[model samples]
Target chain A: MVKKFMALLRMKYIEMFAYQWATLAWSTGAMVQPIITMMVWINIYETEMESFILYFSTLILVERLTAAWDVWDLDRDIREGSFSNYILRPIHPIHWAIAENIIYKGLFLVVLVPAWLVSSFFLPSLQLHLNGWEWMLFISALLLGGGIRFMFSYSCGLLGFWINKVTAVYAMFEGISLFFSGRIAPFSLLPPIMQDISLYLPFRYMIGFPIEVITGSVKGADLGYGFLGAFIWVLIFMGILGFLWHAGLKKNQAVGG
Target chain B: MSIVVDHLNKQFKVHVRQAGWLDAFRSIFKREYQIVEAVNNLSFTIQSGEIVGFLGPNGAGKTTAMKMLAGLLHPTSGAITVEGFIPQEQKAEYKKMMSLVMGQKSQLIWDIPPMETFLVNKAIYEIDDNSFNKTLDELVALLELEPLLNKPTRSLSLGQRMKCELAAALLHRPKVLFLDEPTIGLDVDTQEKVRRFIANYNREHKTTILLTSHYMGDVTALCKRVIIINHGKLLYDGDLDVLTEKLTPYKLLEVHLPTLPNQSWETYGEVDSIEEGKVTLRIPRERIREVSARLLQEFPVHDLNIQDPPMEEVITLAFQEKSHG
Candidate 1:
C-alpha cells in the first residue's frame, strides 16, 4: 500500500507540474476573498485591526492547507465513465484521490509558507506566537481538519453515482459552509446561538476549528471540546464514506462504453 | 473454461424525456423512467487460450456484457466466474489476473507521457522490476512504441495512443483480456497492425481474450469463433465460418466471358450483377462446381472466381434471420 501511494503521489506531482501556472493561480487566487474580508473588518473595527488581521491571515493559510477538490474530479470522472479505469485496477480508487490530495496540499504548503513568512516580516500581526505544545496541537488540528474536509468532499463526490448534478449539490453545501465554517468571520464574532450550532455541525471542524487553535482563541477545556467534536465528525464522515462506496458501486451504471 | 457467464443480465433504469423544452421542464418535476435491459440472459463460456469475437450491432449489449465480465458493472442476475473467481467480487487477486481496454475511453494520463501511467500501474499491480522490464521491452518492440512512449498522450495520434493503451494494459501480462472495440476508428493499415499484434501476443502468451469490434476485419483476422448478440440476448454462438455458412449458404461466382449470352440468365444461377463481358452469380454451395464447369463449356469463359459472402453481409443476414424468426 505504501509503495502504491508513493507511486500515485509521484504521478500526481508530475501532473501538477504540467499545470504549474494553474496551480499557482489557484493557490494565490484563494487568498483574495479572505484578504478582502480582512480589509472590511479592519475598516469596520479600527481598534481591533491587529487581531482581525491575524485571524483572517491564519484563515487563508488553514483554508489552503485543507482545501479539497475531489468532488469536482469524481463528478466529471463518473459522468464521463473514465472512472472505470480506476475501478478495474487492483488497488482501491480512494488511494488515488488521497494521493492527489497530499501532493496538491504539499505544493500549497511550499508556496504559502514563504508567502506567509515574507508577509509577516512586513506586517508583525501576521506572525504566530505559540509554545511547542500549542504548535503541536495546532498542527494536529490542521491535519484533522484536512482529513475531515477530504472525506467530506469525497463523500459528496460519491453521490455522483446516483445523481447527475453532484457538483452543483456540493456547491450548495459549500455556500452554506462559507458562513458556518468562519470563512466570512471568526466564530467568536458570531452570535451565541450560531456558535453553539457550529459546534454541533461538522463545518467548524473542517476549517474554523483549526484557525481557532492557531489564533489562541481555543484553549483549556475548549480545545479539548474542539478535538472531541472534530474526532466525532471524522468517524461520522468515515461511516458515511464507507456506506456510499459500497452502495455506490452497485448503483454505478458505468455510463459510457 | 477460463471464463463462464451463466444467465448474465444487466438492466438500467434510464430517465425518459421528450424532445421539446416544455417536456424537459416538466420532467424536472415529475420524471419518468424506463427500464432498459442492456444484457439479457447472456450465457457463453470461453476456454483457456481462446480468442473469441463478441459480435453485436450498436446497442446490442456487447459492451455491457464486457463491463460485467470485467466487474465494472454489477449484473442484475446470473453468475460470471473467470479462472474460478467471481468477477463482481472484484477481488485483488482476480483483478491482478485480468485487464480491460475500451478503445472509446482512455486510461492514460492526458497531459503526461504514457510512461507515467505505466509506472503507476506497475506500482498498483506490484510488478517486480525484472518482469516489468522484460514485458515492457517485448511490448515496445512489438508495438514499435519507443518513440511514442515519451510523447504526451494528448499529442500522439489516435493510433499511437491506442498502441500505448494496449501496452499499458498488458505490462502485467494479464491472463484474461477484455477488449471493446480495440481497433475502432483506425485506418486499415493500423487496424491490421493491431490485429496482427493481438494474434501474435495471444499465441505467445496463451492469453484468453474476448474482443468486441465493429470492424469485421478485426474479427475475421483474429477470431475463429464468434458469439453474436442482439437486443441483449445471445442469437448465435459458434464458429465464424459455421455462422457464415449457415446464414449465407452460397458462393459468389464471377465469370468473365468473351461475349454476352443472349439466353435468360435465370437458367444458369441467380444473377447478382451483369456487365458487357463480366457476370456475377450467386450459386448454391453444392452446385458451384457443376455450374462453373457448365458455364466454361457453354460460354467461352475467360476467367472465373468463386468466393464466400462478405462477413458483414453474413452478420446482417444472421441478425435479420433471428429478428424475423
Candidate 2:
C-alpha cells in the first residue's frame, strides 16, 4: 500500500510538470483575482490604510494559500465518465485525486509567493502580524481549511451520480460559496448574525476560518477548537460521501443502462 | 490454472422510452423498464495458456462476459473464478495479473504521447525501473511502436493509436488478456498484422487470451478453439474444426473449369452458384472426398477447391438454433 501510494504521488508529479505551462496559466489566473481585489480595496479605503491594508492583504493571502481545484475537475469527471478510469485503477482512486490537488496547490504557492512579496511592498502599511507559533498555527489552519473545502466540494461533485446534469446545481453552489465563504467580501462586512452562523457551518471553516487565523483574530484555545471543528466536518464530509458513493455504485450495477 | 464460469447470468434493467422532449419529461416521473438477459446460464472452462475466440454478433453479451472476467461487472446469479479467485472480488493481485483492451475504448492520455501514458501505468503498477524499461523495449519492438510512441495520441491514426493501446495494455505483461474487438475498424493489412502479433505474443508469453471480435477473419486467423454464444447462452464450445463440422454439416467447393461440363452437376452436390466457366457447390461434409473425386473424373476441371461453410453462416445458424430453442 505504501509503495502504491508513492507510485501515485510520483505519477501525479510527472503529470503536473508535463502540463507545467497550463499550470502556470491557471495559477496566474488565481493570482490575478486576489491582486485585483487588493487594488479595488486600496481605492475604496483611500486614506485609511491601517485596517484596510491589513484586512485586504490578509484576505488575498488566505485565498491564494487555500485554493482548491478538484471541485471543478471532479464535477467534470463525474459528468463525462472520465471517473471510470479512476475507478478501474488498482489502488483507491481518491489518493490520485488528492495527489493531483496537492501538486496544483504546491505550484500555486510558488506563483503567489512573489506576488505576495511585491504587493506587500507596494502597500507600505500592510502588516501581517506573524510570529513563529502563530505562523505555525496559521499554516495548520490553512491546510485544514483546504481539506475541509475539498471534502465539501467533492461531496458536491457526488451529486452527479444522481442528477443527469449538475452544472446548474454546481453553479448555484459556487455562487453561495462566493458570498458564504468570504470569497467576495469578508464575513464581518455581512449581517452580524450571518457571520456568526458561518462559524459553525463547514463553508465558513473552508474559507473564513483560515483567513481569520491569518489576520490573528483566532488565537490561543480558539485555534485548537477551530481545528477540532474542521476535522469533525471533514469526518462528516467523508461519512456522507461514503453513503452516497455506495448508493450510486448500487444504482450503477443494478441497471448499467 | 483455469477459468471457470458456471451458470453465469447478467440481466440489465434498461429504461424504455421514445424520442421527444415531452416523452422524456413524462418518462422521468413515469418510466417503464425492460429486462435484458444479456447472458444466461453460460458455462465454460478455459485452462491457462489457451487462446480462445469468443464469437457473437452485436449486443450478444460478448462484451458483458469479458467485463465479468475483467472484474468490471458482477454476474447476476453465477460464479466466475480465475485460478480460484472470484473475479468480482477484484483482488489487487488478480487485477495485477490481468489486462483488458477494448479496441473502441482507449486508456491513453489523449493530449500527450502514448509513451507518457505508459510511464503513468508503469508508476501505477510500481514496476521497477529495470523491468519497466525491459518490458517497454520489447513491446515497442513487437508492436513496432517506436515511431508512434512519441506522437500525441490525437495525432496518430486509428491503427497507429491501436498499436499504441495494445503496447500500453501489455506493458505489465499480464497473464490473462481480455480483448474485445481488438482489431476492429483496422485496414485488412493492419488487422492481419495485429492477429499475427497476438499469436506470436501468446506463443512467447503463454498468456491466456480470450478475444471477442465481429470480424470472422480475426477468429479464422488466430483462434484454433472457439466458444460460441448467443442471447446470453452458450451455443457451442469446442475445437474450431469440430464446431464447423457439428454446426454446419456441409462444405463449399468452388470449381473453375475450362468450360461448362456437359454433365449435370446436381448429382455431385447442392449447386450454390454458377457463373460462366466457374461453378460453386455445397456438399455434405462426409461426401467431400467422394464428391471431389467424382467431379474431377466427370468434368474437365481446370481448378477445384473444397472449403468449410463460411463462419457467418454458421453463426447465423447458431443464433437461429438458440432463438428457436
Candidate 3:
C-alpha cells in the first residue's frame, strides 16, 4: 500500500511538472488578494500599518500551503466518468486526491520559500521573533491546518455524488470562508460576534490560526486553544470525510465516458 | 464455473422531463422519474476457460450485464459470482482475479507513455518484480507493442493505443476478462489482428472471456457459444450455429449460367436477384442439397454455391421477432 501511494505521489509530481507554468500562474494569482488587502489596510490603519503588512504577507504564504482545489477536479471526474478508472482499481480514489494535494503544496513551496526570503529582506516588518518551541508548534499547526482544509474541501467535493453542480456549493463555502478565515482581514479586526464565530468554526483553524501562531500573535493559553481547535477540527473533518466517502461511493452513477 | 449470474436485474431511476423552460423549472421542485429496466432477470453461467460472446444491439443491456459482472455496478436483484467471489462485494482478491477493458473508455494516462500506467497498475495489483517483468515481456511480444510502449498515449494511433490498453488490462494475468466492444472502430486489419491476439491469448492462458461487440466477425471468430439479450431479456443462449439455424431457416444459393435461362427461375427457388448470367435464389435449408443436384441436372449450370444467411441477418431477425411479440 505504501509503495502504491508513493508511486501515485511520484506520478502526480510528474504531472504537476507538465503544468509548471499553470501552477506558477495560479500561485501568482493567489498572492494578489492578500497583497490588495494589505494595501487597503495600510492606507487606512496608520498605527498598525507595519504589523498588518507583516501579518498579511505571512497569510499569503500560509494560504498557498493550505489551499485545496480538489473539489473542482472531483466534480469533473464524476461528471466525465473518469472516476471509473479509480473505482475499478484496488485502491480508493481518495488516495489520488491526497497525492495531488501533497504535490501541489510541495511545488508551491518551491516557488514560495525563496520568494518569501527575498521579500523579507526588503520588508523590514516581516521579521519574526519566535522561540524554538513556538516555531515547532507553528509548523505542527501548519500541517494540521492544511489537513483540516483539505478534508473539509474534499468533503464538500463529495457532494458532487449527490448534486449535479458542486461548484456553486463550493463557491458559497469559499465566500464565507474568505471573510471568516482572515483572507480579507484579520480575525481580530472582525466584529466581536464574527470573531467569536470564527473561533468556534473550522475556518479560523484552516488559515488564520496558523498564521497567528507563527507571527507570535497567539500565545499562552490562546496558543493551546489554537492547537486544540485546529486538531479537533481536523478530527471532525476526518470523520465527515469518512462518512461522505462511503455515501458518495454508494451514490456514484458510474456514468459513461 | 468462472462466472455465475442468476436472475440478475438492474433498474435505473431516470428523471423524466420534457423540453421547455417551464417544465425544466418545475422539474427542479417536483421532478417525475421513471424506472428503466436495464437488465431484467438475466441469467447465464460461463464456465472456466470458456469464451462467450455477449450479443445485443444498442441499449440491449449487454454492457450493463457486463458491468454487473465486473463489479462496477450493483444488480438491483439477483446474484453474481465471478471466480467464486461475489462481485458486488468488490473484494481485492476478486478484483485481482478479473479485469475489464472498455474500448470506448481508456485507463491509460494520456500524457505519459503507457509504461508509466503499467507500472502504476503493477503497484496497485502488487505484482512482484519478476512476475511483472515476465508478464509485461510476454504481453509486449504477443501484442507487438515494442515500438508503441515508449510513445505517449496521446501520440499513438487508435489501434496502437488499443493494443496498449489490452496490455495494461492483462498485466496482472487475470483469470476472467470482460471486454466491451474491444474492436469497435479499428480498421479491418487491426480488427483481425486483435481478434487473432484474443484467440491466441485465450488458448494459451485458458482465460475465460466475455466479449460484447457489434461486429459479427469478432463474435464468429473468437466465440463458439454466444448468449444474446434484447430489451434486458435473454433471447438465446447456446451455440452460435444453433441460434443462426433457429432464426434463419433458409440458405442462399447463387447459380451462374452460361446464358440467361428462358424459363422462370421461381420454379427452382425464390429469385432474390438476377443479372446477365447469374441468378441468386433463397432456398429452404432442408431442400438445399436436393435443389442443387436438380439444378445441376436441369440447366447448363456453370457454377453453383450455397451459403447460410449472415450472422448479422439472423441476429436482426431475432431482435425483430422479440420486439414484435
Candidate 4:
C-alpha cells in the first residue's frame, strides 16, 4: 500500500512538471492577491506596516501550501463521466485527489520559499524572528490548517453528486471564507465582533490561526486556545468529510459516458 | 458458474420537463419524475471461460445491464454474482477480479503516453512488480502495442488508443471482462484485428467475457451463445445460430444468367432484385434446396447460390416481432 501511494505521488509530481507553465502561472496568480492586500494595508497603517508585510507574506506561503482545488477536478470528472474510471478500480478515488494536492503543494513550495526569501530582503518588515518551540508549533498548526481546509473543500466538492453545479455554492463559501479566514486581512484587524466570531468558526483555524502562530502574535493561553480550536475544527471537518463521502457514493448517478 | 444474474432489474428515476420557461421554472420547485426500466427482470448465467454476446439495439439496456454487473451502476432489484461476489457490494476482491472496458470512455491520461496510464493502473491494482511486468509484457505483445505505448495518447490514432485501453484494462488479468462496444467506430481492418485479439486473449486466458456491440461481426466471430434484449426485455437467449434460425424463416438466393428471362421469377421465390443478368430472391429456408434445383432446371440459369439472411436482418426481425407483440 505504501508503495502504491508513493507511486501515485510520484506520478502526480511528474504530471505537474509536464504542465510546468500552468503550475507557474497559478503560483504567480496566487501571489498577486496577498501582495496586493499587503500593499493596500501597508499604506493604511503606516506604523504597523512592518507587521502587515510579515503577516501577508506568511499568508501567501501558507495559502499555497494549504490550497486544495480537487473540487474543480471532481466536478469536471462527475460531469464528463470520467469518475466512473475511478469507481471501476479497486482503489478509492480520493487517493488520486490527495496525491494531486500533495504534489501541487510540494512543487509550489519550491517556488514560494525562494520568492519569500527574495521578498524578505527587499521588504525588511517581512523578516521573522521565531524560537525553536514557536517554529515547531507553527509547523504543526500549518499542517492542521491544511488538513482542515482540504477536508472542507473536498466535502463541499462532494455536493456535486447531489447537485448539478457546485461552483455557485463553492463561490459563496469562498466569498465568506475570504473575510473570515483572514485572506483579505488579519482577524485582529477586523471588527471586534468578527474577531470574536472567527475564534469559534473553523475558517480562522484553516488560515489565520496558523499565520498568527508563525508570526508569534498568538502566545500563552491564547496559543493553547488556537491549538484546541484547530483540533476541534479538524475533527468536525473530517467527520463531515466522512459523512459526505459516504452519502456522495450512495448518490452517485454514475452518469454514462 | 463464473457469473449468475437472477431477475436483475434496473430502473432510473428520470426527471420530466417540457420545453418552456414556465415548466422549466416549475420543475425546480415541484419536479415530476418517471421511472424508466432500463433493464427489466433480466436473467442469465455464464460458465467459466464462456464468452457471451449481449445483443441489443439503442436504449436496449445492454449497456445498463453490463454496468450493473461491473458494479458501476446499482441494479434497481435482483441479484448478480460474479465469481461468488455480489457486484453491487464492490468489494476490493471482487473489483480486483473484474474489469470493464467501455469503448466510448477512455481511461487513459490523454496528455501522456499510454505507458504512464498503465503504470498508474499497475499501482491502483497493486500488482507486484514481477507480475506487473510479466502481465504488461504479455498484453503489449498480444495487442501489438510495442510501438504505441511510448506515443502520447492524444497523438495515437483511435484504433491505437483502443488497443492501449484494452491493455490497461487487462493489466490486472481480470477473470471476468465486461466489454461494452469494444469495436464501435474502428475501420474494418482495425475491427477485425481487435476481434482477433479478443478471441485469442479469451482462448489463452479463459477469461469470462460479456460483450455488447451493435456490430454483428464482433458477436458472430467471438460468441457462440448470445442473449438478445430489446426495450429493456429479453427477447431470446440461446445459441447464436439457433436465434438466427428462429428469427429468420428465409434465405437469400441469387441467380446469375447469361441473358434476361422474360418469365416471371416470383414462381421461383420472392424476387428481392432483378438486374440485367442477375436476380436476387428471398426463399424460405426449407425450400432453398428445392427452389434452387427448380430454378436451375427451369431458367437458362448460369449459376445459383444460397445464403442465410444477414445476422443484422435476423436481429431486426426479432426486435420487430417484439414491438408488434
CAPRI-style grade of the A/B interface in model 1: high
Candidate 4 regions exceeding 4 Å error are: B298-303
Arrange candidates, best DockQ first.
1, 4, 3, 2
Residue-level lDDT for A22 in candidate 1: 94
lDDT of 1 at A71: 97
DockQ (C-alpha based) per candidate is: 0.88, 0.35, 0.58, 0.69
Give me the runs in candidate 2 sitting further than 4 Å from their true place: A1-25, A30-61, A71-82, A125-127, A158-162, A242-257, B261-264
Residues B37-71, model 3: lDDT tens digits: 99999999999999999998899999888888887
Clashes of 1: 0
Per-residue lDDT tens digits for candidate 1, residues A191-251, read 9999989999888999999999988988899999999999999999999999999899999
Residue-level lDDT of model 1, residues B21-68, one tens digit each, is: 999999989999999999999999999999999988899999999999
Worst 10 residues of 1 chain A by lDDT: A121-130
Candidate 2 lDDT for residue B205: 92
Error of 1 at A168 (Å): 1.3
Write the candidate numbers in order of decreasing lDDT: 1, 3, 4, 2
Error of 4 at B92 (Å): 1.2
DockQ of 1: 0.88
Clashes of 4: 0
Docking class of 4: medium
Worst 10 residues of 3 chain A by lDDT: A248-257
Residue A182 CA error for candidate 3 (Å)? 1.1
